[model samples]
Target: AASLLGAPIGHDLCIISLSDLMTPWERIEKRIRAAAIGDFVTAVYNPKSEGRYWQLYRLKELFLEERSPGTPVGYVRQAGREEQVVNLTTLAEFDPEQVDMFTVILIGNSQSYEAGGKFITPRGYYGEIKMKTDVGIGQDIMIRSFRTIEKELKDKEMPLDKKWALLHAIHTTADFDMENILRIDDHAVASLYEKFNRGEVRTIITDVTMAASGIRKGALQRMGIEVKCYLQDERTIQLATEKGITRTQAGIRLAVQEHPGALYAFGNAPTALIELCDLIRKGKATPAGIIAAPVGFVHVQESKHMVKPFVSIPKLIIEGRKGGSNLAATLVNAILCYNDAEQLKPGRDV
Candidate 1:
């Protein structure tokens, strides 16, 4: 049975027959108490019958004293037979009436979880691929979307990082033509992941409040980072008014001054992108990376084109003036997701 179940039963466990006809009830109780106190995953055979019913309830009571109510419980009746019934439940929901002489009950320790309709006791490989295969709805959607994007780009020849960026651009815009307009340096995508993982990029400066708000705050908090948008700052407003420049441009200049080597994400104002490009050209600011996706008819294309000359730093640009805060935020999140070192293994599907 252990071999058939793929070694789930190989862990420290004790099996006891609940038939009290030959074994005295006192001795059975002692064995149950020992199993419960020792924290052993237990299997009970012949759990109940017509006359022997209260023993299963007694076993539950004894186990409850030591185990949590959420401990997993699995039941199998008529194993290997035609009329077999297998169930996965919890200790709090265990029904003694469901068991009989033909049933085998396997109760789990503190580490088990219900996954894909089965009880899984994690055997210390929580970060392995086997444990990650079953994900929740949000992750499942992202994986499926990536798969679809991969299938659509099967004929294209590009590196995995670039492909990942392109796929995310397409995913954000729902436009297959985005692959043509997306601009990413050869090593920029990889450098972005490295900077993010190494904590080199600690602050994310955005042009607009929408872009700043769209970034996942929880994800940034987990990485010990902060997002900033200085467009509404009083100093920025005063500086912009005094210099006769847009508030976003002044904010970008101020942000670069305050947080050097910060990630710059521009989604709204082309002036902000233009200011960032000017800062880079003048050596006044050294940004970790730039996400330039300003949506406008005026100078959006021109501003993005301006940033093209500076090739020393990482940049993710959505060309042709077809971008907004949502697209910019999506691109940032895509980079964040890719920064997960464990998920970016050599042969990983995503």
Candidate 2:
């Protein structure tokens, strides 16, 4: 493989038969001197045998004297056999006597290690290992959207045409202030920006009040990603524009895209709820078809006229359902996992 790689143009290559068979020592010395001066990543095969041994040292010395001490040298014994041993070390640390007729040695150039790890050398370029965060979202509603994405990544079974399509699909998250409305303060925005830059997140699900507007929008655009804002207030919309956030109004806003999908969840403030209904009425968004908490504290009640049109409305208790959060989470899990629309029932929708 080395000789085949080097056989181009006017560069002369010399191969010495280190085995005690055909080539003479005087001729080998001449070739070695020429090779030492030329500076190449030489491959040595059949450097040792049970009968003859000293030639390996001579070859090593010839290369070592000319090349830098820290140059990478690889030794492979028994090539593809079961007992194969491949060791990579510097020229200064190589032990030539260990080689035999079945062994191969590769002497690399100085910049070899700096270029990348050896494993990636099989490819055309260097490799990189940037610090990354593995998203650990559970198999909840927020995670179902990502489930398809994760499968596509793990399969790597797609054809070349479909590969990039899967990669470009949105892997997102939606957050509703269930307990306390999580605000997007500057600190939170900064943290989110870092995560977005690292490809740890794509779609951000947050309400308008959690943050100032212009920074998140501008920063996300600068990072070359899409940021969809769910359940935004009028003030948050202004702030989102100023923050340069990639604003997609409410979950249904994403339906305007070329590929329309259901919102990850169905519960938010009444204003957001009505916006979702409007989208559904317009045929722009489908009911996620899952009720989040059916018998819980609903802030909004369907009007008498709308109640005839909607099946989701009911009387609200003074306090929210016990473990409303857990029930919502469980329902989302069921919907996402079983692909059962029935999961939306037994509880409240939005």
Candidate 3:
């Protein structure tokens, strides 16, 4: 029903049965919240019945929490049957009085729209891009930017995941030089993604709060990955004084002591990266992977050079003085979406 109604078949979709017969209401509501927050095309089965009319209203309320009132939604009654009936409406205008258990509701994602009475969700199959004034303006702009990056990218021959990561970096900075500077070890993204999925690595230690803040919180929460920054921790302040070290260095030490196997990402602090390297050499830390991209003239180049010897650990490096919190966060985003590399469908969860 969703595909027929013009939901983007190429993008992520969430199918939900709102019947609380065997499933607890809370659990079903949890799924609804996830779908809404993730901005996925949602197809709802068993939306209403004699005893379930209120549930559908609650679901609408949940969707409205994330989506605009004008978001497109469609429904089909007895779809594909002799008495098939389909209707298109905005989310605010979708009337539950007309729906029942036999009806299937299709609520478009943030990018969905109503055109020529057909419900539509656009998920970036970009030969040309058009901006629509709708609930998904931000995503539309991002999709346009991604297509622009694709057209302007210098190296189209790189591996899919690496190229995907580069796209993210270029998107973040608008710096085409990322093609020349960004480096990914063989299968680095895949390895880290596996560890994340297997629950072997659940934490990411960033050198600063800015780096931590830039990471996509929606994906991190869904994957149950914890991002921790110790720079602002009082314990880190105390430790810095005790060790006579820079706050960033102390933060890394404290982070390593707590999560020795977590992925460590460096953005603003070269000293922190240097300190992590020192810890790894001295058997104090065993990070799952390292993102070595600290932007500075002071020890930044040296810090990246220091991390190169640890061939056993996976890595993504941005060479030279071009790195930031956004860059590190976007690289993390790339690995998390590595499974989507071949498909070129980034940002399933915004």
Model 1 misplacement above 4 A:
1-133, 339-350
Q: lDDT for every model? A: 0.77, 0.40, 0.84
Across 1-350, the per-residue lDDT of candidate 2 in tens digits comes to 33222211222334455775676788877777676666554666677777668887887787766664545667778766788876666666789867778887776532222112231011121224321212222323322343234232433222322222122112212222222211111222233323444655444322232221311343345445443444354654564477564343433354333223322222333334344455556767443232222222443344112212434322111113322322323322222222112111111121
Model 1, span 79-132: residue lDDT tens: 888888787787878998888889888887654545556666534333343334
Error of 2 at 252 (Å): 65
Clashing pairs in 1: none
Best first by TM-score, ranked: 3, 1, 2
> How many steric overlaps does candidate 1 have?
0
Candidate 3: worst-modelled 10 consecutive residues by lDDT: 126-135
- Worst window of 10 by summed lDDT in candidate 1: 341-350
Candidate with best TM-score:
3
What's the distance in Å from true for residue 6, model 2?
15
In model 2, which runs have C-alpha deviations exceeding 4 angstroms?
1-16, 114-350
lDDT of 3 at 292: 89
TM-score for each predicted model, relative to the true structure = 0.59, 0.31, 0.63
**C-alpha RMSD of each candidate structure in angstroms:** 17.6, 20.9, 16.0
